[model samples]
Target chain A: MSLLNDLTGAPPGLPPHALLLRLAAIGAVLAGTTCGFAYVGGWLSPGALTPARVIDRFEQVNGPHPGFRRNHAKGLCVEGRFAASGAGAALSKAGLFAAGRVTPVAGRLALAGGQPYAADAEATVRSLALRFTLPDGEEWRTGMNDIPVFPVRTPEAFYEQLLAAKPDLATGKPDPARLNGFFAAHPESAKAAALIKARTVTAGFADSTYRSLNAFRLVAADGRDTPVRFAFVPERAPSPETAGQAVQQDKNYLFDALAAELRQDALRWHLVATLGRPGDPTADATQPWPADRETADLGTLALTGSTPEAPGNCRDVNFDPLVLPLGIAPSDDPLLSARSAAYSQSFTRRAGEDKTPSAVAGAPPHGAAL
Target chain B: MTPSPRFNLPARLLHWSMAALILAMLLIGVAMVTSLADYHALVSLHRPLGILILVLALLRLANRRRHAPPPLPADLPMWQRRAAHASHVALYALMLAMPLVGWAMLSAARYPVALAGPLVLPPILPQSPVLYAGLRSVHTVLAYALFGLILAHLGAALLHALIRQDGVFSSMAPWRPRRAAPTLRPEG
Candidate 1:
């Protein structure tokens, strides 16, 4: 009893009545701290969808390819320069849009799945991620994909899609029923898939148009902001043989063709910004603006050289979509922040893993003259 | 020389300011990990705030060396005194280690700790994925441990003020409690 008293009771000098109050206060503090721990530890809210959880789901689906991105694992690096066309100055005051202003760029071209060794033919969505280093030490990094619009609107729906797409152990492909259910639930995704399917696959990455599916704000010098969606439109016309028709027997056919194209001469793409009206949906990536929206030629991106993925200049870059320069800012696009978070998590995970050298053959060394 | 009955002005100021800052850091750290919408803004605030805490911790340690804290009440139990000492040591260790470990984790991941415009802290450790993963885990565990210690410290301080009325809490409190008699000695 004395031991219990000592444990729960007030100190020797304090009155007996004080014990109750002290016990209550102590209980309150304990309860408060318990709640704090629950909140901070993410226990209070069970099954909460978090960035870490999303990345973890990617790992679960992809089966742990170390030292590679959680998504778009198979890739090759490219280096070049972005030359401003001067036309984009009217839309925004970004230096990259200033006529004659040229900036260095390190970029990665990759397929959309998490399998680093997946066959080139399996890739339906191709991606181009670039980091443009400005003269003032600021950077504008963007991750663009060939798709006209993203499949989902919010991160939660994206997570649902990821779960639905998880391959079954027996078939090694996403269950058709689950996928159909997902598409049925998310009509936006169904519409996007239809639109993507309607477009013909380009002969190679060099001829493909890479789009910023999310909208962003271009801040003018006068502090006015213009909502815009942009795309890197390839200068090369699509070859007669479409990518779907020309799926070669080689597993790395897409990357090989890109390398071969780069060897002949530098490839170029025009940066075109599609201005948005006041009523345009800045928050939804799945919705595209009307085809008649005005566009401004921002600049030309020239791919002067290529490198293998692992040792390349773009190896360590996260290419976060939200890393914009002073004159540019993210729109209300919910996907932008989600993309940044997921990219950061992916970068952190891959940074700790032993990087397997990319299987992309016959690429120039890391610092070859651009 | 006899120690002053109350904490020195610098010590008091540092204690309160650091208390506020540390609480804010903990909240920001949790928010950064959980919320995507506020992650960027929180990160911009988190990096500088961590460095500030680190600098203030160093200054507080140095001040503590030069001027010792007022002695605890004589009536306090031996175990309680020992716990107080141990918890203070752990608190100080975390105050120093959390930022250093966070900085090291970022360094290991090759992340730039941008403090302000044109000011970035150089990486303190070589970039290594294994080290980053380990340090990141350690930092998180220590944060929870620190939270627990703070709760205990607060509970003890309340005990001193409300029940014991021993002037122990008033020694470091920003304002003196009316019931704390000036004649109360270190030996309660």
Candidate 2:
């Protein structure tokens, strides 16, 4: 009956039964998709796997490092003064960031992952885990990774990735196909892999940038809440030789470099936070906020001195992000809670081992000196 | 043979274009889940392709609403006729649902849903790992359902052309004058 009916066309009638079937089809689709999603949500979350079990699995696969827990096993503990600027107070009323007030900072620097003996040259990620002890007895702790984005989005996915990366019994090396399959299914991993390949490795800890890679809610004194992700941007430029250089001058070059730098003068890093807009990601650690997002330089972190034995100070302290001050709180990011749980499990296991801290005999109290 | 009536040109164009896009999406989806070498390339391709399919599906729905399709043959069994209508409805629903689900899944996972630099879509839902995982599984399952429905649709079209010799196939693709005649018009 239409103008184009001269060509091939459907019959001119719409039977009531056909219309009813169409309506039923629409209902079925809506119900099916929603129910399917609900079923998946109900079954396959962190609830299906406990943090303790995941840690135990990690130990089973990697074999626990004797003195160190899970990640950043080889580290140098240092004492510092963190002076917050007026800008920091504007973002959060936390005492640690009060204008010009110095908070005692105890922190560690390490090669990423669990191998204590891994060389600087072999490391792909560097870590800067810190704990700021405020005068009011409140503490702000953060475990930062040099990599901008994480390899996976969720802790459950991370557990699966670790299990897949664990070495096979036959060859004593992880199966390449399994890792490949994991990567293929999880396309979010491509961002991290590409970044690792593209960015030039920093020669030492002094020049590297550490990204928190997790969003947190920062509430101001006036009760306005802003989601923020912060980064430790280095004041010193990286040496040209660091770019694509495979050879480390020595096995302990990073630690030696940081210690040497600290001995001369306090090393400074801008503690900056990127403010998140309304739709910014709060749950996923793998996602980086947009570059042009509003950012505030919260303060300066000055590394005053380093300790040869970090086990004395930082080893007992879990640098849990959830250990927030009054004005700062964990975002809904599942990784934040997951990390807190995992860190507790790790701390419990390591402390239970009853391994005595190999205290550097005659070393001065570093935090008190700072 | 009489010059059989066909769907309006806009409807035919939208049908074939969407058919090609959906098939490509299915194949790419399969390849992306299997091969690491192809994963990055396929994912990049998948995002833009998904958005295109979504846009075209909307346009097709609008067109279909204004221009009703030709009716089934009178001799067609009631069950088969009902199946034909239901499948089309399912296919259309999937075309609309898949892209939105993928976008929301990425949002929930806190990943950028972008086709290029500065082109990221706003998050459709808050970041929640549980929600992300669930949506991801739903997207995959629906994709498989879509793929199966497509195959059945193809089978029905062929049966109409070869055995029934009805003009149903021609209703959407009318360039070919005879049942077996070849033409520049692409087959779904």
Candidate 3:
């Protein structure tokens, strides 16, 4: 017993590899890149959550914007520029710009679980969301889902579908017949539904795609107002065999993969707005931008050092169509209007609930089945 | 009177290992309560780990009671003995309190506990903002109290090793008394 005890005490700590892992995690948290133990990672401490840093970091990436104001006390204020301001279209024109690069992007991939939905696993269809912070302190938030379309058009409809799809009050799960009827009734969701049906399902919170259903006008160099759809296509589509399989003890596969790729290869995106070509229909995401193959813009976005995360430059800077400048205005689609309204509600809802601990996001419609 | 035997090696090991984890956890916990943004995940990670510590601490106590530890020095003063026992008692009680308080806080906060991967821990307490706020305060204060107790323990151990030249340091020391080990024999 003494010999056995002696051997163990000599080590007197967590396993060697475990210790290394802890050190690595601590290092990453300090660096503000990896979300350590926390499933959602960003700023660690409140004092560290300063608006000045967020703005400055944005300025550093996108270039100096005189319109951007930091009053040393009023948080952060930035004036909007129409997409056509095409003012500083190139890197040279912009003072602190990274120029067309998509370097630093944090991707969250999750599934659309259909039941009690309390845990992180059990559904599939890859939901991907990413936010970009240009050096000028300008922020862009892009949310996309794997499927091209979604189940509902309006926020009100969305709410209704979710409530109907939620579990039966008595049984505590979705009624199969009710679920089928709900899907059948909403044939408009056929595109998304077909893709979802064929797609191999994975971890609920890990395997899903999120879409920006409403049309967004892409203010091209020439200031054209054409309807466009944006997506967060997986950089490299994983094998179908990899579908629905959560790695043992791996809490953050998507994050880990994204971090490695950012470190290894430069990230790029196709910033194609609806061309609104003669044959194409106007931008109405509710009705698909009339059959133009998604074009590639070859814009480059690189993360210089820190992550452009929430409340950071990208997150803090408001990106509502209501606030868009003269050139890149929101299209006149009812769904677009509804999205703006719904997203506004979600934003305010999220913000308000965030203040109190009881306001967890696990509420009905989005999270827990109720 | 007969002296009790020293704690079993496994029990002693779990004891100190948990001690380190608790200290580190307390510091991180203090940092976490302030940063409300990512607080969810931190709170989630913290709850289960705290519960694990509490259960482990309880088992340690039961084991110790069943298999009492070796006795203190015969020459030890009454005051020193009292201090040692009191500090240890505080540590164990705190080990139990912090986690239970955190669990209650989350229950009030209406947050579900995702235990070790997919297993969702049942909420042991009902939702009550007032109770949650109070429990949160209790958890924080107890953490500070725990820190104070740890410091006192460390200071006393150092005092025994350096100034008092006594046997207190041997209480949790990993070494066993050997025949050739030096002792503070009185000067002639």
Q: Candidate 3: list runs displaced more than 4 Å.
A: A1-139, A168-173, A199-211, A220-223, A234-238, A241-244, A247-269, A272-294, A302-326, A353-370, B1-188
List A-chain TM-scores for all predictions.
0.90, 0.80, 0.51
Q: Candidate 2's error at B185, in angstroms? A: 99
- Residue A204 lDDT in model 2? 77
By the DockQ metric, which is better: model 1 or model 3?
Answer: 1
Q: What RMSD, rounded to one decimal, does every model reach?
A: 3.6, 17.6, 24.2
Error of 3 at B133 (Å): 19
State the lDDT of candidate 3 residue by residue for A1-370, as single tens digits. Answer: 3343233221223355643454454444333422332322224443353222333343343333232221111111111211212222431222212243333343323333321112333233444444443333233444455555555654344544555556676996678786677667766554545655565543332223234555556554455445555543333333443544454524434434333444445433333333445444333343454454654332332222213232323222223333222223355544444433333322322222222111112112323442
Tell me how many residue pairs clash in candidate 2: 11
Shift in Å, residue B184, candidate 3: 99
Model 2 over residues A1-370: C-alpha lDDT tens digits?
3322212122235344543454455456555644543443333243556556667777777676754667677778888978888798878988777788888898888776566666665345888988887643356888888787777888778888887777688996779999888888777775766765566667778888898888988898898999999899988886633444447366676677678788779998889999999888887777777789999998899998887753346655567666666788778877776776676556645644545443222234347655
Clash count per candidate:
1, 11, 45
Candidate 1: CAPRI quality band: acceptable
Best by lDDT: 1
Candidate lDDT scores, in order, read 0.83, 0.71, 0.46
Q: Write out the backbone clash pairs for model 1.
A: A352-B129
Better of 1 and 2 by TM-score: 1
